[model samples]
Target: MALNLNDLGIFVQAVEHGSFAAAGRRLGMPKSTISKRVAELEAMLGARLIHRTSRSFSLTDVGRDFFEHARASIIEAENAETIVRTRLGEPSGTVRLTTSVPTAQFTLAPLLDRLAARYPKLLLSLHVTDRFVDIVQEGFDIAIRSHQQPLPDSALVQRRMAAHDFYIVAAPSYLDRYGRPEKPADLAGHNAIVANAAETSWRLLAADGTLQRALVNPVMAADEPFVLLRAASSGIGITVLPTSVCATAVIDGTLERVLPEWTAGQITTTILMPHRRGQLPAVRAVVDFLLEHADAQSGVLNSLANA
Candidate 1:
Protein backbone atom coordinates (compact mmCIF):
# COMPACT_ATOMS: atom_id res chain seq x y z
CA MET A 1 0.00 0.00 0.00
CA ALA A 2 1.33 3.40 -0.95
CA LEU A 3 1.28 5.98 1.86
CA ASN A 4 1.49 9.71 1.46
CA LEU A 5 3.56 11.69 3.95
CA ASN A 6 1.34 14.70 3.22
CA ASP A 7 -1.64 12.72 4.44
CA LEU A 8 0.18 12.16 7.71
CA GLY A 9 0.73 15.90 8.06
CA ILE A 10 -2.94 16.56 7.35
CA PHE A 11 -3.91 13.91 9.90
CA VAL A 12 -1.72 15.53 12.51
CA GLN A 13 -3.12 18.93 11.60
CA ALA A 14 -6.68 17.64 11.95
CA VAL A 15 -5.97 16.19 15.37
CA GLU A 16 -4.11 19.25 16.65
CA HIS A 17 -6.63 21.75 15.36
CA GLY A 18 -9.52 19.70 16.83
CA SER A 19 -11.51 19.36 13.61
CA PHE A 20 -11.04 18.81 9.91
CA ALA A 21 -12.67 22.16 9.13
CA ALA A 22 -10.24 24.01 11.35
CA ALA A 23 -7.27 22.16 9.92
CA GLY A 24 -8.48 22.81 6.40
CA ARG A 25 -8.76 26.50 7.16
CA ARG A 26 -5.20 26.57 8.44
CA LEU A 27 -3.94 24.56 5.48
CA GLY A 28 -5.99 26.61 3.00
CA MET A 29 -8.15 23.67 1.91
CA PRO A 30 -11.70 22.53 2.42
CA LYS A 31 -12.86 20.41 5.32
CA SER A 32 -14.08 17.70 2.91
CA THR A 33 -10.66 17.62 1.38
CA ILE A 34 -9.11 17.18 4.81
CA SER A 35 -11.56 14.36 5.62
CA LYS A 36 -10.83 12.58 2.35
CA ARG A 37 -7.09 12.76 2.88
CA VAL A 38 -7.41 11.48 6.44
CA ALA A 39 -9.59 8.63 5.26
CA GLU A 40 -7.05 7.76 2.58
CA LEU A 41 -4.30 7.78 5.19
CA GLU A 42 -6.34 5.37 7.33
CA ALA A 43 -7.03 3.15 4.35
CA MET A 44 -3.30 2.96 3.55
CA LEU A 45 -2.48 2.09 7.16
CA GLY A 46 -5.38 -0.41 7.35
CA ALA A 47 -6.50 1.18 10.61
CA ARG A 48 -8.99 3.92 11.32
CA LEU A 49 -7.50 7.03 12.83
CA ILE A 50 -10.70 8.97 13.63
CA HIS A 51 -14.29 8.24 14.52
CA ARG A 52 -16.50 10.55 12.49
CA THR A 53 -19.82 11.93 13.71
CA SER A 54 -22.47 14.33 12.42
CA ARG A 55 -21.49 17.13 14.80
CA SER A 56 -18.09 16.16 16.14
CA PHE A 57 -15.43 13.49 15.90
CA SER A 58 -13.31 11.36 18.20
CA LEU A 59 -10.18 9.28 17.76
CA THR A 60 -10.38 5.52 18.21
CA ASP A 61 -7.93 3.75 20.52
CA VAL A 62 -5.87 2.82 17.45
CA GLY A 63 -6.19 6.43 16.27
CA ARG A 64 -4.91 7.69 19.59
CA ASP A 65 -1.88 5.43 19.31
CA PHE A 66 -1.24 6.46 15.72
CA PHE A 67 -1.59 10.15 16.33
CA GLU A 68 1.59 10.17 18.41
CA HIS A 69 3.32 8.12 15.73
CA ALA A 70 2.20 10.52 13.00
CA ARG A 71 3.38 13.54 14.93
CA ALA A 72 6.73 11.87 15.61
CA SER A 73 7.12 10.99 11.96
CA ILE A 74 6.54 14.59 10.95
CA ILE A 75 9.17 15.78 13.45
CA GLU A 76 11.65 13.16 12.31
CA ALA A 77 11.09 14.13 8.71
CA GLU A 78 11.82 17.73 9.60
CA ASN A 79 14.97 16.71 11.43
CA ALA A 80 16.12 14.74 8.40
CA GLU A 81 15.59 17.78 6.21
CA THR A 82 17.49 19.97 8.63
CA ILE A 83 20.37 17.52 8.58
CA VAL A 84 20.46 17.50 4.80
CA ARG A 85 20.43 21.30 4.59
CA THR A 86 23.19 21.71 7.14
CA ARG A 87 25.46 18.95 5.87
CA LEU A 88 25.29 19.95 2.23
CA GLY A 89 28.37 21.65 0.72
CA GLU A 90 26.50 24.17 -1.41
CA PRO A 91 22.87 25.11 -0.97
CA SER A 92 20.92 25.14 -4.26
CA GLY A 93 17.22 25.85 -4.76
CA THR A 94 14.83 28.63 -5.76
CA VAL A 95 14.29 31.16 -2.98
CA ARG A 96 11.35 33.54 -3.44
CA LEU A 97 11.89 36.95 -1.86
CA THR A 98 9.47 39.85 -1.29
CA THR A 99 10.35 43.40 -0.28
CA SER A 100 9.75 47.05 -1.09
CA VAL A 101 10.80 48.52 -4.44
CA PRO A 102 13.72 50.50 -3.05
CA THR A 103 15.22 47.54 -1.24
CA ALA A 104 14.85 45.43 -4.35
CA GLN A 105 16.69 47.99 -6.51
CA PHE A 106 19.49 49.26 -4.27
CA THR A 107 19.95 46.25 -1.99
CA LEU A 108 18.77 42.79 -3.03
CA ALA A 109 19.27 43.29 -6.77
CA PRO A 110 23.06 43.42 -6.59
CA LEU A 111 23.14 40.69 -3.98
CA LEU A 112 21.22 38.39 -6.27
CA ASP A 113 23.99 38.80 -8.83
CA ARG A 114 26.54 38.04 -6.14
CA LEU A 115 24.63 34.93 -5.04
CA ALA A 116 24.44 33.65 -8.62
CA ALA A 117 28.20 34.08 -9.07
CA ARG A 118 29.00 32.55 -5.68
CA TYR A 119 26.53 29.66 -5.91
CA PRO A 120 25.87 29.05 -9.56
CA LYS A 121 23.33 26.35 -8.82
CA LEU A 122 21.10 28.55 -6.67
CA LEU A 123 18.06 30.31 -8.17
CA LEU A 124 16.13 33.36 -7.01
CA SER A 125 12.76 35.01 -7.69
CA LEU A 126 12.02 38.48 -6.36
CA HIS A 127 8.77 40.35 -5.79
CA VAL A 128 8.70 44.07 -5.12
CA THR A 129 5.87 45.88 -3.39
CA ASP A 130 5.20 48.33 -0.60
CA ARG A 131 2.05 46.63 0.64
CA PHE A 132 1.84 44.27 3.57
CA VAL A 133 2.58 40.68 2.53
CA ASP A 134 1.35 37.57 4.27
CA ILE A 135 4.55 35.58 4.09
CA VAL A 136 2.92 32.21 4.64
CA GLN A 137 -0.19 32.72 2.53
CA GLU A 138 1.72 34.50 -0.24
CA GLY A 139 4.27 31.66 -0.58
CA PHE A 140 7.29 33.90 -0.29
CA ASP A 141 10.40 32.19 1.11
CA ILE A 142 11.70 35.38 2.70
CA ALA A 143 10.71 39.02 3.28
CA ILE A 144 12.56 42.22 4.15
CA ARG A 145 11.31 45.24 6.10
CA SER A 146 12.89 48.51 7.19
CA HIS A 147 11.32 50.28 10.15
CA GLN A 148 12.09 52.99 12.67
CA GLN A 149 11.10 50.91 15.66
CA PRO A 150 10.52 47.28 16.59
CA LEU A 151 7.70 45.80 14.58
CA PRO A 152 4.44 44.70 16.14
CA ASP A 153 4.19 41.13 17.48
CA SER A 154 3.90 38.53 14.72
CA ALA A 155 4.56 34.84 14.15
CA LEU A 156 7.29 35.40 11.54
CA VAL A 157 10.88 34.93 12.74
CA GLN A 158 13.02 38.07 12.39
CA ARG A 159 16.75 38.62 11.88
CA ARG A 160 18.23 42.08 12.38
CA MET A 161 20.40 43.35 9.51
CA ALA A 162 22.20 46.67 9.09
CA ALA A 163 20.93 49.73 10.95
CA HIS A 164 21.57 53.26 9.71
CA ASP A 165 20.32 56.63 10.81
CA PHE A 166 17.62 58.32 8.78
CA TYR A 167 19.22 61.21 6.92
CA ILE A 168 17.45 64.52 6.35
CA VAL A 169 18.66 65.69 2.96
CA ALA A 170 18.05 68.32 0.31
CA ALA A 171 19.69 69.58 -2.88
CA PRO A 172 22.38 72.26 -2.59
CA SER A 173 20.11 74.51 -4.63
CA TYR A 174 17.26 74.03 -2.14
CA LEU A 175 19.57 74.97 0.73
CA ASP A 176 20.81 78.01 -1.12
CA ARG A 177 17.28 79.09 -2.04
CA TYR A 178 15.55 78.41 1.29
CA GLY A 179 18.62 78.66 3.49
CA ARG A 180 19.66 75.71 5.74
CA PRO A 181 17.68 75.23 8.93
CA GLU A 182 19.62 76.24 12.02
CA LYS A 183 17.66 73.94 14.32
CA PRO A 184 15.23 71.01 14.18
CA ALA A 185 12.29 73.35 14.82
CA ASP A 186 13.53 75.53 11.99
CA LEU A 187 12.34 72.83 9.57
CA ALA A 188 8.73 73.51 10.52
CA GLY A 189 8.52 76.34 7.99
CA HIS A 190 10.28 74.52 5.11
CA ASN A 191 8.77 72.41 2.34
CA ALA A 192 9.07 68.64 2.93
CA ILE A 193 9.12 65.89 0.31
CA VAL A 194 7.92 62.79 2.14
CA ALA A 195 7.59 59.10 1.34
CA ASN A 196 3.88 59.51 1.87
CA ALA A 197 1.42 61.95 3.29
CA ALA A 198 1.36 60.05 6.58
CA GLU A 199 5.08 60.69 7.23
CA THR A 200 4.96 64.42 7.88
CA SER A 201 6.27 64.06 11.41
CA TRP A 202 9.94 63.36 12.10
CA ARG A 203 12.01 62.70 15.21
CA LEU A 204 15.58 63.94 15.04
CA LEU A 205 18.47 62.98 17.32
CA ALA A 206 20.46 66.09 18.21
CA ALA A 207 24.23 66.22 18.71
CA ASP A 208 23.80 66.13 22.48
CA GLY A 209 21.76 62.91 22.27
CA THR A 210 18.51 64.79 22.85
CA LEU A 211 15.37 63.92 20.96
CA GLN A 212 13.82 66.61 18.75
CA ARG A 213 10.45 66.28 17.09
CA ALA A 214 9.58 68.36 14.02
CA LEU A 215 6.60 68.26 11.74
CA VAL A 216 7.09 69.55 8.23
CA ASN A 217 4.49 70.42 5.65
CA PRO A 218 4.45 67.97 2.77
CA VAL A 219 5.15 69.62 -0.59
CA MET A 220 5.28 66.35 -2.52
CA ALA A 221 4.80 62.67 -1.76
CA ALA A 222 6.04 59.57 -3.53
CA ASP A 223 6.10 55.91 -2.49
CA GLU A 224 9.31 54.93 -4.29
CA PRO A 225 12.59 56.01 -2.71
CA PHE A 226 14.21 56.96 -6.00
CA VAL A 227 11.30 59.23 -6.82
CA LEU A 228 11.68 60.96 -3.50
CA LEU A 229 15.45 61.23 -4.05
CA ARG A 230 14.90 62.73 -7.46
CA ALA A 231 12.54 65.32 -6.06
CA ALA A 232 14.91 66.18 -3.22
CA SER A 233 17.83 66.54 -5.63
CA SER A 234 15.77 68.86 -7.84
CA GLY A 235 15.56 71.47 -5.04
CA ILE A 236 12.02 70.44 -4.12
CA GLY A 237 12.42 70.14 -0.34
CA ILE A 238 14.23 68.45 2.51
CA THR A 239 13.18 64.85 3.19
CA VAL A 240 14.08 62.40 5.88
CA LEU A 241 14.73 58.87 4.62
CA PRO A 242 16.72 55.80 5.56
CA THR A 243 20.42 56.08 4.83
CA SER A 244 20.36 53.07 2.49
CA VAL A 245 18.04 54.98 0.18
CA CYS A 246 19.98 58.24 0.42
CA ALA A 247 23.58 56.97 0.56
CA THR A 248 24.25 57.23 -3.17
CA ALA A 249 22.82 60.73 -3.54
CA VAL A 250 24.85 61.92 -0.57
CA ILE A 251 28.09 60.36 -1.88
CA ASP A 252 27.77 61.93 -5.36
CA GLY A 253 26.68 65.33 -4.02
CA THR A 254 23.32 65.25 -5.76
CA LEU A 255 21.86 65.84 -2.30
CA GLU A 256 23.37 67.52 0.75
CA ARG A 257 22.60 66.67 4.35
CA VAL A 258 20.25 69.00 6.19
CA LEU A 259 20.95 69.76 9.84
CA PRO A 260 24.37 68.04 9.87
CA GLU A 261 24.44 68.24 13.65
CA TRP A 262 21.20 66.21 13.95
CA THR A 263 20.04 62.95 12.43
CA ALA A 264 16.52 61.70 11.82
CA GLY A 265 15.10 58.49 13.33
CA GLN A 266 17.33 55.41 13.16
CA ILE A 267 15.98 52.79 10.83
CA THR A 268 16.79 49.08 11.06
CA THR A 269 16.54 46.59 8.24
CA THR A 270 15.22 43.14 9.16
CA ILE A 271 14.96 39.77 7.43
CA LEU A 272 11.76 37.87 8.12
CA MET A 273 11.17 34.17 7.48
CA PRO A 274 8.05 32.09 7.90
CA HIS A 275 9.64 29.83 10.47
CA ARG A 276 12.92 29.53 12.30
CA ARG A 277 12.90 25.73 12.12
CA GLY A 278 12.80 23.60 8.97
CA GLN A 279 14.40 26.30 6.80
CA LEU A 280 15.62 24.90 3.48
CA PRO A 281 19.34 24.96 2.75
CA ALA A 282 18.80 27.38 -0.11
CA VAL A 283 16.78 29.74 2.07
CA ARG A 284 19.31 29.53 4.89
CA ALA A 285 22.15 30.21 2.47
CA VAL A 286 20.33 33.22 1.05
CA VAL A 287 19.76 34.63 4.52
CA ASP A 288 23.42 34.15 5.47
CA PHE A 289 24.55 35.64 2.17
CA LEU A 290 22.49 38.75 2.87
CA LEU A 291 23.87 39.07 6.38
CA GLU A 292 27.39 38.75 5.02
CA HIS A 293 26.82 41.70 2.72
CA ALA A 294 25.27 43.91 5.40
CA ASP A 295 27.73 46.78 5.86
CA ALA A 296 27.46 48.39 9.28
CA GLN A 297 29.78 51.25 8.36
CA SER A 298 27.96 51.93 5.10
CA GLY A 299 24.40 51.01 4.20
CA VAL A 300 24.31 50.30 0.43
CA LEU A 301 25.06 51.84 -3.01
CA ASN A 302 28.88 52.06 -3.26
CA SER A 303 29.33 49.28 -0.71
CA LEU A 304 27.09 46.86 -2.65
CA ALA A 305 28.84 47.62 -5.98
CA ASN A 306 32.25 46.67 -4.52
CA ALA A 307 31.28 44.15 -1.82
Candidate 2:
Protein backbone atom coordinates (compact mmCIF):
# COMPACT_ATOMS: atom_id res chain seq x y z
CA MET A 1 0.00 0.00 0.00
CA ALA A 2 1.33 3.41 -0.97
CA LEU A 3 1.44 6.03 1.81
CA ASN A 4 -0.72 9.10 1.37
CA LEU A 5 0.85 12.41 2.28
CA ASN A 6 -2.39 13.47 3.96
CA ASP A 7 -2.38 10.39 6.15
CA LEU A 8 1.25 10.85 7.13
CA GLY A 9 0.54 14.53 7.84
CA ILE A 10 -2.30 13.59 10.17
CA PHE A 11 -0.16 11.01 11.98
CA VAL A 12 2.66 13.53 12.42
CA GLN A 13 0.24 16.15 13.72
CA ALA A 14 -1.33 13.69 16.18
CA VAL A 15 2.11 12.89 17.58
CA GLU A 16 3.00 16.58 17.79
CA HIS A 17 -0.19 17.58 19.59
CA GLY A 18 -0.09 14.41 21.71
CA SER A 19 -3.76 13.60 21.03
CA PHE A 20 -6.20 13.17 18.16
CA ALA A 21 -8.50 15.87 19.56
CA ALA A 22 -5.65 18.38 19.85
CA ALA A 23 -4.46 17.56 16.35
CA GLY A 24 -7.98 18.00 15.04
CA ARG A 25 -8.20 21.39 16.72
CA ARG A 26 -4.85 22.49 15.31
CA LEU A 27 -5.67 21.22 11.79
CA GLY A 28 -9.23 22.62 11.94
CA MET A 29 -10.64 19.17 11.16
CA PRO A 30 -13.10 17.03 13.06
CA LYS A 31 -11.69 14.63 15.70
CA SER A 32 -13.10 11.67 13.77
CA THR A 33 -11.33 12.79 10.57
CA ILE A 34 -7.96 13.09 12.33
CA SER A 35 -8.34 9.70 14.00
CA LYS A 36 -9.43 8.05 10.76
CA ARG A 37 -6.49 9.45 8.78
CA VAL A 38 -3.98 8.31 11.40
CA ALA A 39 -5.55 4.84 11.40
CA GLU A 40 -5.35 4.73 7.62
CA LEU A 41 -1.69 5.72 7.78
CA GLU A 42 -0.92 2.88 10.22
CA ALA A 43 -2.82 0.39 8.09
CA MET A 44 -0.93 1.48 4.98
CA LEU A 45 2.39 1.02 6.79
CA GLY A 46 1.31 -2.25 8.46
CA ALA A 47 2.46 -0.98 11.83
CA ARG A 48 0.88 0.40 14.98
CA LEU A 49 2.09 3.97 15.15
CA ILE A 50 0.18 5.30 18.14
CA HIS A 51 -0.97 3.81 21.42
CA ARG A 52 -4.06 5.60 22.58
CA THR A 53 -5.65 5.62 26.04
CA SER A 54 -8.64 7.59 27.39
CA ARG A 55 -7.07 11.07 27.73
CA SER A 56 -3.66 10.75 26.12
CA PHE A 57 -1.67 9.20 23.27
CA SER A 58 1.89 7.92 22.84
CA LEU A 59 4.01 6.84 19.89
CA THR A 60 5.04 3.21 19.54
CA ASP A 61 8.65 2.23 18.70
CA VAL A 62 7.78 2.03 15.02
CA GLY A 63 5.94 5.36 15.24
CA ARG A 64 9.03 7.05 16.73
CA ASP A 65 11.11 5.97 13.74
CA PHE A 66 8.37 6.89 11.28
CA PHE A 67 7.81 10.23 12.96
CA GLU A 68 11.40 11.37 12.37
CA HIS A 69 11.22 10.71 8.64
CA ALA A 70 7.68 12.04 8.45
CA ARG A 71 8.66 15.28 10.14
CA ALA A 72 11.58 15.83 7.76
CA SER A 73 9.42 15.15 4.73
CA ILE A 74 6.76 17.52 5.98
CA ILE A 75 9.30 20.30 6.53
CA GLU A 76 10.72 19.82 3.04
CA ALA A 77 7.26 19.92 1.56
CA GLU A 78 6.48 23.10 3.48
CA ASN A 79 9.76 24.65 2.37
CA ALA A 80 8.96 23.79 -1.23
CA GLU A 81 5.58 25.46 -0.90
CA THR A 82 7.21 28.55 0.65
CA ILE A 83 9.65 28.74 -2.22
CA VAL A 84 6.88 28.57 -4.78
CA ARG A 85 4.75 31.09 -2.93
CA THR A 86 7.70 33.43 -2.64
CA ARG A 87 8.43 33.24 -6.35
CA LEU A 88 4.76 33.63 -7.34
CA GLY A 89 3.45 36.00 -4.71
CA GLU A 90 4.55 39.21 -2.99
CA PRO A 91 8.17 39.20 -1.81
CA SER A 92 7.40 39.16 1.90
CA GLY A 93 9.02 36.87 4.45
CA THR A 94 11.82 36.58 6.99
CA VAL A 95 15.27 35.85 5.53
CA ARG A 96 17.90 34.51 7.89
CA LEU A 97 21.40 35.56 6.77
CA THR A 98 24.89 35.63 8.19
CA THR A 99 28.19 37.36 7.53
CA SER A 100 31.48 38.26 9.15
CA VAL A 101 31.11 40.68 12.09
CA PRO A 102 33.01 43.62 10.61
CA THR A 103 31.27 43.46 7.24
CA ALA A 104 27.86 43.08 8.87
CA GLN A 105 28.33 46.14 11.05
CA PHE A 106 30.00 48.43 8.51
CA THR A 107 28.48 47.24 5.24
CA LEU A 108 25.49 44.89 5.11
CA ALA A 109 23.65 46.10 8.22
CA PRO A 110 23.19 49.62 6.86
CA LEU A 111 22.07 48.22 3.53
CA LEU A 112 19.52 46.00 5.33
CA ASP A 113 18.12 49.03 7.12
CA ARG A 114 17.40 50.63 3.76
CA LEU A 115 15.82 47.42 2.47
CA ALA A 116 13.61 47.05 5.56
CA ALA A 117 12.33 50.56 5.22
CA ARG A 118 11.56 49.98 1.55
CA TYR A 119 9.91 46.59 2.07
CA PRO A 120 8.03 46.72 5.31
CA LYS A 121 6.82 43.12 5.07
CA LEU A 122 10.33 41.70 4.83
CA LEU A 123 11.96 40.51 8.04
CA LEU A 124 15.75 40.31 8.11
CA SER A 125 17.70 38.22 10.58
CA LEU A 126 21.41 38.99 10.63
CA HIS A 127 23.82 36.69 12.45
CA VAL A 128 27.30 38.18 12.79
CA THR A 129 30.15 35.77 13.27
CA ASP A 130 33.84 35.32 12.52
CA ARG A 131 33.74 31.54 12.77
CA PHE A 132 32.49 29.51 9.82
CA VAL A 133 28.83 28.49 9.79
CA ASP A 134 27.14 25.65 7.95
CA ILE A 135 24.39 27.67 6.28
CA VAL A 136 22.19 24.76 5.23
CA GLN A 137 22.51 22.82 8.48
CA GLU A 138 22.00 25.98 10.53
CA GLY A 139 18.79 26.87 8.55
CA PHE A 140 20.10 30.08 7.04
CA ASP A 141 18.30 31.23 3.90
CA ILE A 142 21.33 33.18 2.66
CA ALA A 143 24.90 34.03 3.52
CA ILE A 144 27.22 36.83 2.32
CA ARG A 145 30.94 36.20 2.10
CA SER A 146 33.77 38.51 0.96
CA HIS A 147 36.67 36.62 -0.54
CA GLN A 148 37.97 35.75 -3.97
CA GLN A 149 37.03 32.07 -3.87
CA PRO A 150 33.55 30.57 -4.12
CA LEU A 151 31.81 28.59 -1.38
CA PRO A 152 32.71 24.88 -1.17
CA ASP A 153 30.42 22.53 -3.05
CA SER A 154 27.86 20.53 -1.11
CA ALA A 155 24.42 22.04 -1.63
CA LEU A 156 25.24 25.72 -1.95
CA VAL A 157 24.67 27.78 -5.12
CA GLN A 158 27.19 30.56 -4.96
CA ARG A 159 26.76 33.83 -6.91
CA ARG A 160 29.41 36.46 -7.32
CA MET A 161 27.88 39.71 -6.04
CA ALA A 162 30.57 42.36 -6.39
CA ALA A 163 34.30 42.90 -6.37
CA HIS A 164 36.20 45.48 -4.35
CA ASP A 165 39.85 46.20 -3.74
CA PHE A 166 41.85 46.17 -0.52
CA TYR A 167 44.27 48.80 0.72
CA ILE A 168 47.13 49.39 3.13
CA VAL A 169 45.97 52.03 5.64
CA ALA A 170 47.46 53.80 8.66
CA ALA A 171 46.73 56.85 10.78
CA PRO A 172 48.35 60.21 9.91
CA SER A 173 50.23 60.09 13.19
CA TYR A 174 51.75 56.71 12.30
CA LEU A 175 52.65 57.97 8.80
CA ASP A 176 54.30 60.99 10.37
CA ARG A 177 56.30 58.80 12.73
CA TYR A 178 57.45 56.02 10.34
CA GLY A 179 56.69 57.55 6.89
CA ARG A 180 54.75 55.80 4.11
CA PRO A 181 56.40 53.15 1.95
CA GLU A 182 56.80 53.95 -1.77
CA LYS A 183 57.01 50.23 -2.65
CA PRO A 184 55.94 46.82 -1.27
CA ALA A 185 59.45 45.91 0.03
CA ASP A 186 59.51 48.98 2.32
CA LEU A 187 56.72 47.35 4.50
CA ALA A 188 59.36 44.98 5.98
CA GLY A 189 60.54 47.56 8.52
CA HIS A 190 57.02 48.75 9.51
CA ASN A 191 55.19 47.56 12.62
CA ALA A 192 52.00 46.29 10.91
CA ILE A 193 48.86 45.66 12.93
CA VAL A 194 47.57 42.42 11.44
CA ALA A 195 44.05 41.08 12.00
CA ASN A 196 45.07 37.42 11.73
CA ALA A 197 48.34 35.50 11.60
CA ALA A 198 47.13 33.82 8.43
CA GLU A 199 46.55 37.30 6.94
CA THR A 200 50.18 38.23 7.69
CA SER A 201 50.81 37.83 3.94
CA TRP A 202 49.47 40.43 1.52
CA ARG A 203 48.82 40.01 -2.20
CA LEU A 204 49.35 42.83 -4.68
CA LEU A 205 48.90 43.16 -8.43
CA ALA A 206 51.75 44.31 -10.66
CA ALA A 207 51.29 46.69 -13.57
CA ASP A 208 51.61 43.80 -16.03
CA GLY A 209 48.91 41.75 -14.22
CA THR A 210 51.47 39.73 -12.28
CA LEU A 211 50.89 38.78 -8.62
CA GLN A 212 53.25 40.14 -5.99
CA ARG A 213 53.11 38.54 -2.53
CA ALA A 214 54.69 39.92 0.64
CA LEU A 215 54.96 38.49 4.14
CA VAL A 216 55.15 41.06 6.96
CA ASN A 217 55.25 40.06 10.59
CA PRO A 218 53.04 42.34 12.65
CA VAL A 219 54.18 43.81 15.94
CA MET A 220 50.51 43.80 16.99
CA ALA A 221 48.18 40.95 15.99
CA ALA A 222 44.45 40.60 16.71
CA ASP A 223 41.82 38.01 15.92
CA GLU A 224 39.12 40.64 15.33
CA PRO A 225 39.17 43.15 12.47
CA PHE A 226 37.50 45.87 14.48
CA VAL A 227 40.10 45.50 17.22
CA LEU A 228 42.86 45.78 14.66
CA LEU A 229 41.15 48.83 13.16
CA ARG A 230 41.04 50.47 16.56
CA ALA A 231 44.70 49.72 17.11
CA ALA A 232 45.45 51.13 13.65
CA SER A 233 43.37 54.23 14.41
CA SER A 234 45.59 54.88 17.42
CA GLY A 235 48.59 55.19 15.05
CA ILE A 236 49.85 51.68 15.92
CA GLY A 237 50.93 50.46 12.44
CA ILE A 238 49.92 50.00 8.84
CA THR A 239 47.33 47.30 8.09
CA VAL A 240 46.24 45.72 4.82
CA LEU A 241 42.44 45.54 4.68
CA PRO A 242 39.47 45.89 2.39
CA THR A 243 38.69 49.47 1.45
CA SER A 244 35.13 49.17 2.75
CA VAL A 245 36.47 48.06 6.11
CA CYS A 246 38.29 51.35 6.57
CA ALA A 247 36.00 53.61 4.52
CA THR A 248 34.49 55.52 7.43
CA ALA A 249 37.80 55.98 9.22
CA VAL A 250 39.53 57.17 6.06
CA ILE A 251 36.66 59.58 5.31
CA ASP A 252 36.73 60.97 8.83
CA GLY A 253 40.53 61.39 8.63
CA THR A 254 41.08 59.01 11.53
CA LEU A 255 43.03 56.75 9.18
CA GLU A 256 44.85 57.52 5.93
CA ARG A 257 45.51 55.26 2.96
CA VAL A 258 49.15 54.19 2.63
CA LEU A 259 51.01 52.79 -0.39
CA PRO A 260 48.65 54.32 -2.95
CA GLU A 261 50.68 52.82 -5.83
CA TRP A 262 51.01 49.15 -4.81
CA THR A 263 47.68 47.49 -5.52
CA ALA A 264 46.05 44.74 -3.51
CA GLY A 265 44.27 41.95 -5.35
CA GLN A 266 40.57 42.48 -5.87
CA ILE A 267 38.29 40.84 -3.31
CA THR A 268 34.91 39.61 -4.47
CA THR A 269 31.77 39.37 -2.38
CA THR A 270 29.56 36.32 -2.91
CA ILE A 271 25.96 35.42 -2.06
CA LEU A 272 25.38 31.79 -1.11
CA MET A 273 22.22 29.67 -1.21
CA PRO A 274 21.51 26.06 -0.40
CA HIS A 275 19.89 25.69 -3.82
CA ARG A 276 18.31 27.99 -6.38
CA ARG A 277 14.93 26.28 -6.09
CA GLY A 278 14.93 26.38 -2.29
CA GLN A 279 15.32 30.15 -2.07
CA LEU A 280 12.74 32.02 0.05
CA PRO A 281 11.23 35.36 -0.98
CA ALA A 282 13.13 37.40 1.61
CA VAL A 283 16.38 35.79 0.61
CA ARG A 284 15.98 36.78 -3.01
CA ALA A 285 15.07 40.31 -2.02
CA VAL A 286 18.13 40.67 0.18
CA VAL A 287 20.43 39.33 -2.51
CA ASP A 288 19.04 41.75 -5.05
CA PHE A 289 19.35 44.59 -2.57
CA LEU A 290 23.00 43.82 -1.96
CA LEU A 291 23.81 43.99 -5.66
CA GLU A 292 22.05 47.32 -6.01
CA HIS A 293 23.73 48.57 -2.87
CA ALA A 294 27.11 47.72 -4.29
CA ASP A 295 26.34 49.59 -7.48
CA ALA A 296 25.20 52.66 -5.58
CA GLN A 297 28.38 52.72 -3.53
CA SER A 298 30.61 51.99 -6.49
CA GLY A 299 31.75 55.59 -6.95
CA VAL A 300 32.99 55.89 -3.38
CA LEU A 301 34.51 52.44 -3.57
CA ASN A 302 36.19 53.18 -6.88
CA SER A 303 37.82 56.24 -5.38
CA LEU A 304 39.02 54.18 -2.42
CA ALA A 305 40.33 51.50 -4.71
CA ASN A 306 42.24 53.98 -6.82
CA ALA A 307 43.50 55.87 -3.78
What TM-score do all the candidates reach, one by one? 0.74, 0.69
C-alpha local distance difference test of each model:
0.81, 0.77
Model 1 lowest lDDT segment of ten = 298-307
lDDT of 1 at 99: 92
Candidate 2 lDDT over residue span 206-269, tens digit each: 6567777876768888866678789999988888667667777887899887777666766788
Q: Which stretches of candidate 2 lie over 4 Å from their true place?
A: 1-90, 197-201, 215-217, 276-279
RMSD of 2: 7.8
lDDT of 1: 0.81
User: Which candidate leads in lDDT?
Assistant: 1
Which clashing pairs does model 2 show? Answer: none
